[model samples]
Target: MDLEVRHLRVVCAIADAGSITKAAAGLGLSQPSLTAQLRRIERYLGGPLFVRSRQGASPTALGEFVLAKARTVLPSIDAIQVESALRAGAAPDRRPLRYVATPGPLMVGLLEELRELFPGASPALRTETHVPTAVDLIASGQQDLAAVVEYLRPVPVPPPPDVVARTVATEPAFVLLPAGHPFATRPAVGLAEFADAEWVLPPNQACGLFEAFTAACVDAGFTATIRHEAESSAARELVARGTAVGLGQATFRSTPGIVPLPLAGCPLLIRQVLLWHRDGPLAAHAREITEGAERAYAAAVRRSPHYLAWLAERPPPGAEQGWAGAGDAPP
Candidate 1:
């Protein structure tokens, strides 16, 4: 049978993952099916591609050669698909851009920019609590693009195949406290300082923020005492009323009864990425969206007095300087 780009991708996945089971999971295929396909591929090439052992599969000499070729060919195919999608997006019959994102300050700005970019096309904007869900939608052609925020941990999860992601912004997270809270007057507060403070965190499934917050607290030698399940609006209100404290984006606006303060070491950072399928029509607009989000985040920082003060504070060495000035705002 003639080989295709998809076949090459499968081979590369197996090689990179170093196991059929892992490769199958990454490729969204069943292990038995992937194993069968590998056998057929081996037969078509007149040789075995992998050396199977108790640990995992390793590439044979011939497998290494084929895998190298696949690596080279797959990227070229991806480039071709991206270019084609760009052309398709600009075509006269192009559909209106459909985009989804987790609701936040960055998305608020991104949607506005998209509207301005495609005035003729009424782009669809959707809110998804989970970034992975947005990524899946874009990959499945259900959406044109997605704005996702990933909390960097010890091990970061990779995006799905055929989906391209661009880092739009990377900024430190902040602590939102009541205006009258003692910590509100501090230049910066550490997660450990709030160990005994009640936290108003969103549900674990709402976004990566909850997980990141808890993880940071753990690293600081404390467990966050979650008193209320809240997000964006509710979290704001809770912090404002002094009922609980919560985490906020660096670009978070200062409310009447709340203050946003940066963390002492800036251990928690959120990386905002714009994602789209390489073969989808919206691939061409990814850059436009990314640039727009950056601008919007900067604007938000400028409007947020508390964020400005947090920026003025002495950040720890090697801290993210990307969000220092209004030009480098992050959400």
Candidate 2:
């Protein structure tokens, strides 16, 4: 019995979480079901793939060897799917580009840009946040593309082993305050000055951004008081009403009643990146959509005096190399 892609995926998830139960939950499968899948794979390989202990499950030496091979073949499955879809006459516009994003000012122009560039294309967009779910959705083929803004220090995420990442932009952190707040008059402020101030942040997957925000405050010798946890727009509302001060990216759109102050000496700026499956060749429409996103990103940056500085030549940090056929313009 040859081990299949499903089996390898189950095994890889187990290795990643180091617990079969957690892995099952992460992959949205029952523990028994996942266990059964693993058992069959081990039987086919004629060896134990994971070593179970009080500490949890760790891939055995044999398991690691098998996984290395599985990794190589897993991507081919996605390629096969793409080819099948293409042969069936899946045009780019009609073909869904499964996209997952967190609603923020950065993404405001993304969809419009896609519409402008690929007029006939209709993207299937879903909203998700938190790094883990976003990564899993892409890996599981639930999403074809994703937009992400992560903390300055790297979070524990699997390397883009089966996916491709493109860094579109980086936004310096800003302290958003009520329009008339005392600090609003200051040209810039440091995180330490707001150590005791109440803060509002994004919820859902955007929750992970707080981790980096907190870490930066830790470095600054103070703890942030979280007043609310919701979407970026909600946070903006909170700051506008003087409920709390909050962090924001340069890509954010300003609400009339709030002002943004530069967070001096804070290295916790948001790094935005786009992700897609490496195994699948992008459809012409999807390619056009991404190019449109690039243009949108470029225009949005140009419209903002602060972000315009990033528009210069050198690549923004964490910006992955562009896709082979997906360039600055549509093919």
Candidate 3:
């Protein structure tokens, strides 16, 4: 079989995730399919590229060499595509603006801003449950812009060369518990306070949030007993009905029977990012979209009474500054 950029990406994903199961999730592929593909690639190369163990898979010598070359080649290829698109004036004025995002209240606010920014230009919207998939869509020119959530630890995965990403906001995660649950009325609760509580967390493949949530639970000296798996609306519904507790953004709207509390010590954080093809039709509006996202987040913060109270107790420096200036382009 011939090697391709997509195949190279598969290899990199496996190396980075350290396991086929996790890598498949990141790639939006099934584990079994990815495993079979790996076997074929290995056969084509005449040797195994990974050493699998109970913990995960590690690259073999040949795998390391190939991966190293892939890292260099893929980015260059991406750059060429971007440059070509730019020179070709890829932005088509007739096409409706395409926007994709991970599900959340933040997206609602962003869409509102978009409407105000481009009057009469209704953008096409898609909700991707996985951040990497949303990013890949933008990188592949399948979407014009994407709003994704990422964790700040272990370093965020870099955007593909064809894409440019900027951080619109960084906010601490809040705990959502049953309104009558103990510590629900507290101003702020530490992770340890919920060590024994049942968690309704999104699957790890949803984004880095899952991993961060698990790590925080471990740091608090207990493994979280995740009883349900859902993301966005479903997760919120479970928390609201008092079926299980979950984590949410600071701007989480409190529904009846649901209490959102700031995590004391702020051990977990979620970064909201906007990504778009660097040379695509939407590139010209990148700054505007980024600014809109920040404004939307700031508005959400102001709307959340619980978040407001937490900010009042220990205000972050420049808390009052509008979020427009808070954005920074990710490397």
Q: Which stretches of candidate 1 lie over 4 Å from their true place?
A: 1-94, 312-331
- As for model 2, its CA RMSD to the true structure in angstroms is 7.3
Residue 281 of model 3: what lDDT? 56
Tell me each candidate's TM-score.
0.66, 0.63, 0.66
Which 10-residue window of candidate 3 scores lowest in summed lDDT? 317-326
Give the winner by TM-score: 3
How many clashing residue pairs, candidate 1? 0
Model 1 TM-score (2 dp): 0.66
Q: What is the C-alpha RMSD of each candidate to the true structure, in Å?
A: 8.9, 7.3, 8.8
Q: Would you list the clashing residue pairs of candidate 1?
A: none
Span of 10 residues, lowest total lDDT, candidate 2: 320-329
Candidate 1, poorest ten consecutive residues by summed lDDT: 321-330
Best by lDDT: 3
Across 245-303, the per-residue lDDT of candidate 2 in tens digits comes to: 88777765657888877777545656566666666544334565566667777776666
lDDT of 1: 0.73
User: How displaced is residue 162 in candidate 2, in Å?
Assistant: 0.9
What C-alpha lDDT, on a 0 to 100 scale, does residue 1 get in candidate 3?
Answer: 75
